[model samples]
Target chain A: MKYHGGHFICAVWKLDIRLWQLLIMASLLLAGVWFRDFSLYPAQIAFTFAAGLITQAIFLRLFKLEQHGFLSATITCFGLCLLLRSSALWVHPAVASLVMASKFLIRPQGAHLFNPANLGVVLGLSFFPETWVTSGQWGQDLTTALWLIAAGFFIARNAKRLDITAYFLLFYASLFLVIRVAWYGYTLPVFFHQFQNGALLLFAFFMISDPMTIPRHHKARILHAAVVAVLAYIWQYQLYWNQGIIWGLFWATFLVPLWNHLFPAPRYQWQALSGEHT
Target chain B: MTTRLIFLLLALSISQTSQAFCGFYVAKADASLYNQASQVVMTRKDDKTVLSLMNDYQGELKDFALVVPVPQVLTEGQIHIGDAKLFKHIDDFSAPRLVEYHDEDPCQPPVMYEKMMSAPMPTAAMPQKAKSDKSLGVTVEAEYTVGEYDIVILSAKESDGLEKWLQASGYKIPKGASAALKPYIKQNLKFFVAKVNLKEQNKTGLKFLRPLQFAFESPKFMLPIRLGMINAKGPQDLLVYILTEKGRVESSNYQTLKLPSNMDIPVYIKDNFADFYKALFETQVKKQNLRAVFTEYFWNMGWCDPCASEPLSYEELKQLGVFWLNQNSNAPQVMSGGGVPVQVTRLHVRYTPDSFPEDLSFQETRDTENFQGRYVLRHAWQGKPEQCEAAKTYFEQLAKRHEQEAKTLAELTGWELSDIKKKMNLNDAPDQESTDQWWKKIW
Candidate 1:
């Protein structure tokens, strides 16, 4: 069937990538909860989304800003539910609210400064005594890993930001290989085992590859990804900190404005891309 | 009135004793129960680590030698032979316990289980030698005798040199040990080699070798499990008792699994707790492909639920390398559940060299949640049948519960379901119920 011009272009290009993101994230959540014994309760998940959405709504009304959508808030909630673990139920919603509020409260240049999920996790771990991130929750399972990579690639492709994911994974994996195999005299399988991690893959495909939070310019984004990868490797292997990807991303967000200033490009608009194929 | 008051006081004392226990402790599975198991007590705060390696070597004292990778050269003051009782204390305190709870009378007003308490029963539970040469690129950093062992700290340039030096010094180094030594050597880690000094051993008047304890400062919070795996016969069991200031210590490299706990099992398990525990562990190890670090227990060092034994005294903890216990001047003499500074996380791993390639890297999580590999054995009420319907219902449910317990045991130990049913004697009631039940085989 033949389609109309602009509508078809919109359908093909700017098809609310958040919709795909939500679907992917929801599937991941379901898979984690069902298959992996990911130490999450249904009530905790419900409370997290409720708290995040309510906080986002309140902030939008208070600031008198045009309510873009709850899509971003939903994504952030899913990310929090997927990552953060606590013995107490209240930590989930409390961290969710603070993370959502930060998105509105700590706007550096009319843009959300930190990735809400990353900020919430880092802050939750640092501030609260009970909260933690279970990096080994996703054990080295080949089938689950391949599925995540495929799904992540599809989502990134839809967002038209696969380059960042590709670059981050490449740099991060290569650095791990170098350290383990070249420097440490470990076997080749040890280098490959690092790639089979579900946490690292999730961070690369979902967290670090967030199109909105990363640098706008392509070159700046590449540089930003590389910097985060290096910092994460250092934070993990050198400083021996947990949630290295999160801490690295949290620190690297400070440099986004610098990268923006150095290599200025049009701010990424969710609805700007139209399928007038390049 | 005076007699009544005296009776009340007597009752109060009895109730206090009952309430003190979380459950009726029946049996325990400690480190001493397992063959070929090595226990290591690691007291870590910041970069400072005090590791006490418990030697379970049962062979001739002369043949026993230990080679461990250390981050720095340990001086004579840094190395000491620790009291063996420290391990026994920690092991008894943290062992996976079997707790029994007796059922209450169904007709009576719901009284606490403590009121109907029954008496709890107690249940019973590496090498090196070295010679140095400049051509072999082996350097002996320090040499000393600590207690019954002669200790030497060696730093090597290559694996071959390390192997040759050890062989020349009359230490029986395992084949392929050189390959294992290479990684640690390349990382610039020094080796702590200990051999039994027969003259010193005779002086101690002890039949068993004492645990070797050493202190060091390093950025790496890891146990070099790879070196231990070099010449392991089958899979080796390593029980790590990590004493940290904050929270749980889990393997960063491999998955750290909390052993399945708090489930009711066949009451017969109380008699065979050791066998049951071995089977349960073997089943889980098989399920995880022998690649998981199972957390047998994690709790505040001061207290326990259904405690297998008493909490270690401050002096005992200090003897076990807990240096920070005295930091808080106002710490309590009698330890309880909460407000204890030191957290004990016990991790058990049945790992082979192939399954675990890297050394066990650890990260102390902020999760202060208490966990233990505790099994429950609910003792059914031995009372006779009464005219009341409640008693009848109770008996019926008890049978069903017994069947469930049998099934749970079957799942846990991979025992035959029929065999467990026979052992539990839950066959007659369940069979009758199954025949009459409408939902049974309806599909």
Candidate 2:
């Protein structure tokens, strides 16, 4: 989007998709707190931002990556606040700093390897015994799932990263259908019930469709998503580990560079100073 | 706040449970409440798990049979008969409690005081077998007689042979049991079949069947609910008590919600606590469309805030098969009387086969936050409203408080609002008439 002239609509049209992402995430958090009865506190959210933004600033100066902005950090903070739940207050801030630091530390080919929020959840669940991902906190409510999808459609449309989300959902639902519905004789409601999960939908639209961490080429991204689906199915169903959806993406991040090398394309940029889509 | 021990009625409902954890009480007995409600106490740490199934089979001993899927065949040493009293005590300890508080004199400054009318606080809280056959593609791995029960472990190649084998063995499984049993068979899970041994049952001379306890190690932390749904008349209720070393336990596949607690209700509910609770639970089940698991109580066994039937003692904990703690080396070093902070989470669910198609999968989370279904009752002082300025304020507050309590009860139980107001004598209250502008008061 570019500023064609000094018109209000043109200015609004020039808004980056990430700004919509930022607004949607904040609204979703509020909706979760109000409607879903999320067991989250304002202090935890405050601490997460306090830690995440500070870590982002320190890394920007320390690593001389000032070209990047705080939008991603803010979005990651919302993700962490939404996904990670802990009884202790300090776990929020501590994990926030570590996750923000990971964005800079765990990079390959000058791009972040793991989604910052995905890595946060993975590390928190793996290392901190006191922290956990409440996967079932978001019940399989149809209305909530639809709301996520509607919001996702609007935001992901502008980002032009809908392929991975679509691919991930297809592959994941196929695995679920084949195993639970077809092989195990579970009713189709059970299969559909699994997809109506708000957490899973949120992962599809917000987490997996993240343009930076995903492969640049379209085909490679789809393949990457399929790999995630299979690995996540094995991790959750076969290996019986908790939070396998996020762990699926966490494990698949190692293959991003390989996918990029296999099918090459230009790196994604959120901002083009001269205003270009690519 | 001064405490008043007026009534200690715990109205928490303990579902009379069996099934979907697998098998049926078979047939030809009173298929009523006990058939619909099944209770299981599962304790886990690491890969080790001990499951105690409460078999409240209110039927003839010959007809009572239970089939459950185990990850592997259990040896004779792995099975034992559990004390029925343990289930009762654990139920009472975890049931929702009603606490009462009396309003102090408004003229005097606030003072903290404690009063107890009774020494003991009351709470309302409230399984088996297997076999094998060959050439029918069913293999009976092992059989044993363990105290009033004949247990057989079966590994079936397919559900058809297993169903036939069970029927041939005089187990009288329900129709369509094969379809229900195929998933487990496909998963290669061994089924443990238990039947009441008439002679051994007679030797015990006890009317009720003792709980069946099994100790095993499996990485799959889940309970199969599909098989039990085959025997369902409508919606079945399941009550699970999870004891874990790390923290609270929640179903990974189903949403686990905490029941509304610590709310004030009308004083008349003290006597009608049981009916109140039943209505509240039904209302919640209906509201969630029978798709969620409700956490009634979650607290560490070391201590409780109001101390509902003294936290399970170390000996009692061991009896429940909590394997992480050692009796000798793990003595309490601090005031937390118990060792290794055992957390007990009570989960209840009401579901039909349609609503819940999959087995309940659970994961232990690192949440040590204490929660309980403690309803409060506030007793208004009998002083006249003309005594002092604070007295006038207290009387006004009391009327509004009563009104608020009435609304809460109606909302919580889905009761008729007018009927609740009639029960509280709230419609005729003079203060209600004084506030004619509803919009002005709402703000």
Q: How far in Å is the alpha carbon of A44 misplaced in model 2?
A: 0.8
- Model 1 lDDT per residue over B1-443, tens place: 42453244234211111134446787899987778888999999999999999888877777777888999998899998899899998998999999888788877878644443221200001243445688999998998988998888999999899988888887777787787788789888999888888899999999999999999999899998877776676988999999998888888877778888889998988889999999999999998888788899987776666778877777777877788776455442333435468889999999887788778888888777778888998888777668476888989888778878988999999999999888887666557556678987686
Using lDDT as the measure, the top candidate is 1
Report the lDDT tens digits of candidate 2 across residue range A1-278: 45557787665666677778888999989988776667787877987897788888988999997977898899999999999987666677778888888888977888878898998888788787567888888888788889899999776766888889999999999998888668866668778878888899999999999999999999999899999999999998888888778989988989999999999999997742224442
lDDT of 1 at A138: 77
TM-score, model 2 to reference: 0.89
Q: What is the interface RMSD of each candidate, in Å?
A: 9.1, 9.5
lDDT at B128, model 1: 38
Residue-level lDDT of model 2, residues B1-443, one tens digit each, is 00111011112112211111111111110112234478889999888999998876766677777888899999999998999878877777787777677788998898855433221100001122333347789888998999998888989897889887877777767787887787788777999888778899899989888999999999999987777777677888888899998688999998889888878899888777777777888899898889899998887776555545656666777888987666764432223333245789999889888788788999999877778777778888989989989999999889989989999999999999899999988877865755776776778
The i-RMS of candidate 2 is 9.5
Residue B39 of model 1 has an lDDT of 90
Per-candidate TM equals: 0.90, 0.89
